[model samples]
Target: MSIFHLMLSSVVIFFVLYAPQPLLAQFAQLYATSPANTGLLMSVTMLPLAIAPICYGLFLANYSKLKLLKVAMMLLALCSVLITLQQRFELFLLLRFIEGLILPAALTAMTSYIGQTWQGQCLRRNMTWYVGSTILGGFLGRALAANFATWWNWESFYIFNAALLILISLRIKLPPLENITTPKACSPKDYLRPLKQPSLLRLYCAVFCMFFCFSALLNYLPFILSNEYNLKDPKLIGWVYGGYLVGALLSMCAPYLTKLHNNNWVILTAVFGVYCVSISAMQWQNLGAFIVLFTLFCACMFIIHASAAPLANEISSAHASITNGAYVSFYYSGGALGSFLPGFIYQTAGIEMFLLSLLLICILGAYFTWLNYRIGSETQLGR
Candidate 1:
C-alpha cells in the first residue's frame, strides 16, 4: 500500500507537470504567440524545477516527507483550478509558475521517501516502479490534455487534474520512517556538496544532456507534426506520443538490463548510442519511421533515468536528499533550457539543424557516460 501510494503520487506529480506539452499548438493559436514564446509554458514550469534543490532543499529538509507531499499536492491542485479559470495568458503563465514552485516539494518528498525506505533489491524494485509510474504519467498528461482540449476546451483539463490531485492528497499515506535526509540543518552548500565527487558530476552532466535532448524533441514535436507532416488535428497529434508508452516498459526493464550488463555505465552508453541513432534517423522525412525512432528514443531516455537516479542516490547516501535534489535540479535544468532554447534553432535553421543540435547533445551525453565507465573501471582495478 505504501508503494502503491508512492506510485500514485508519482503519477500525479508528473501528470500535472507535463499536462501542457501537447497543448502547445492550441495555446499558440489562442495566445497569438510564436512557438518560442508559447514554449515558455513548458519552460516556466521547468525553470523553477531546475533550481528546485537549491531553492527548496532547506525547507524540505525539516518537514515530514509524507506531510509535505500532501500539502504540495493540494497547492498544486489549487493552481490547477486557478489556471482553469484564468483568462489572461500572463495570468496563466503566472499560475503555471506557481505550480512549478510547489511541484518540487512533492517530487523530493516522494523520491526521498523511496531512497530512505528501502535498500538493495527492494530499493531497485521500488525505484523502477516509481520511474515507470512517472513515465505513465507523462504519457497520460499529454495524451489526455490534447484529447480533452479537442473534446471540451483547452483550459478545462486542469479542472480534472485538480480534482484527481485532491483525491490523492486525501487518501494517500506513508508510514513514518526515520528521516535520514535532514542535516542538523540544511544549506544550499549542503546540496552543492554532492557535486564534488567526480563520478556524480559526470552522472549529473550526462543526465542533463539526456533530458535536454528528450525535452527539446518532445516540446517541439507538436509543431513538427502540425507543420511538416500537415497533421493539424490535436487528437492525431496526441497519438503521435503513443510511442512514449514504450518508455515505461523499458524503465521497468532497468534492473534486468543492469544485471545483464553488470554495469550501469555500459548500459547507459549503449542506450545513448541507440538514442543518438534514433535522433539521426529522425532526419529521414518519413512519419512512420520517425515514430519508430521516437519509441526507441523514449526507451533509451527512461532506462537511463531509472539507472542513473538510484545510482546518484547510492553514491551520495550520506546526503540522499541533497543528492536526489541535485539530480532533479540538473534534470530539469536541461529540460528548462531544452524546452525553450532549441526553438530558436528550429525556427531559424530548420528541423534538420534542430535535430543535428540534439544529436550533438546526445553525443555529449554518451561521452559523459563513457567517462563514468572509465572512472568506474579504474576504481574497480584499484579495489
Candidate 2:
C-alpha cells in the first residue's frame, strides 16, 4: 500500500501537469492566441515546478515530509477544482500557478519517503517503478485529456484528475521509516549543498539537456502532426501520444538495463543515440514513421531518466530529498525551456528545423553523459 500510494502520486503529478500539452493548438485557436502564448499555459505549470522545489527543499526541510506531502496534495486538489470550474482563461492560469507551487512539496516528500524506507537494490527497483509510474502518468494524462476533451469537454480531464487526487490524498498514510534523515531547518547552505558535488553537478547539466530536448519535441509534436498531416481533431492527435506508453514500458526496464551493462553511461549513450536517430527521422514527414520514432524517443528519454535518478540518490550523501529536488529543478527547467522555446523556431524555420534542433540536443546530451562518466569515474551504477 505504501508503494502503491507513492506510484499513485507519481501518476497524479504528471497527469495533472502535462494534460494540456496535446491541446496547445486547440488552445491557440480557441483563444486566438499565438502558439507561444498558448505554450505558456504549459510553461506556467512547469516553471513553477522547476522553481518551487528549491524553495520547498530549502524552507520545509525540517518538517514532517509525509504530512507535508499530504498537505501539498490537498492544496493541489483544491487548485485543480478551481481550475476545472473556472471559465476565464486568466483565472485558470492563476489556479494552475498554485497547483505548480504545491507539486514540488508532494514530490520532494515522496523522494524523502522513499529514501527513508528502502535500501540498496531494493530501493533501485522500487524507484524504477516509481519512475515508470511517472512516465505512464505523463503518457496517460496528455493522451487521455485530448481524447476526453474530444469526447466531452476540454475540462473533463481536469475534473476527473481533481477528484482522483482528493481520494488518493485521503488514503495515503505515511509510515515511520528507518535510515531517513530529515533536515532540522532550511538555510542557504542547505539549498546549495547539492551544487557542491562535481559528478552530481554534471548529472544535473545532463538532465537539463535531456528534458530541454524532450519537452520541446513533445510539446510541438501535435502542431507538426496537425499542420503537416492535417490531424486537427484532438482524438486523432491523442493516439500519437500513446508513444509515451512506450516510454513508460522502457522506463520499467532501467534496473534490468543497468544489470546488463552495469554502467549508466553506456545506457545513456545508447538511449541518446536512439534519440538522435528517431528525432532525425521526424523530418521524413511519414506519420507512421514519425509516431514510431517519437515513441522510441520518449522511451529512450524515460529509460535514461530512470537510470539517472538512482545515481542522484546514491551520490547525495545526505539530504536525499534536497538533492532530488535540485535535480528536479534542473529537469523541469529543461522542460519549461522546451515548453515555450520551440514556438519561435517552429514559426520561423518549420518542423524540419525544429527537429534538427532536437537532434542537436541529443548529441549534446550524449557528450555531457560521456564527459561526466569519464571525469567522475563513478562506480558501475545501478548495481
TM-scores for the candidates = 0.88, 0.87
lDDT of 2 at 382: 25
Best by lDDT: 1
Q: Which residue window of length 10 is worst by lDDT in model 2?
A: 177-186
lDDT of 1 at 226: 81
Evaluate model 2: give its TM-score. Answer: 0.87
Error of 1 at 348 (Å): 3.0
User: What value of lDDT does candidate 2 attain over all alpha carbons?
Assistant: 0.76
Give me candidate 1's TM-score against the actual structure. 0.88
Name model 2 segments beyond 4 Å from true. 20-39, 84-87, 143-159, 175-186, 228-235, 378-383
Question: lDDT per residue, candidate 2, 1-383, as tens digits?
Answer: 47887899789877888888777888788778787777677667777788888667665455667778778878877777777667666776777777777788887777766765677777778788888888778778877888898999777778888888888888877558433355454567855765677767777888888889888887677778889989898778767877787667867877787666767777777777877788888788788888888888888888888877777777766476677778779898888878778778898999878878877877888877777667655533522
Evaluate all candidate structures by whole-model CA lDDT and list the values in order. Answer: 0.80, 0.76
Give Cα distance to truth, residue 316, candidate 1, Å. Answer: 1.8
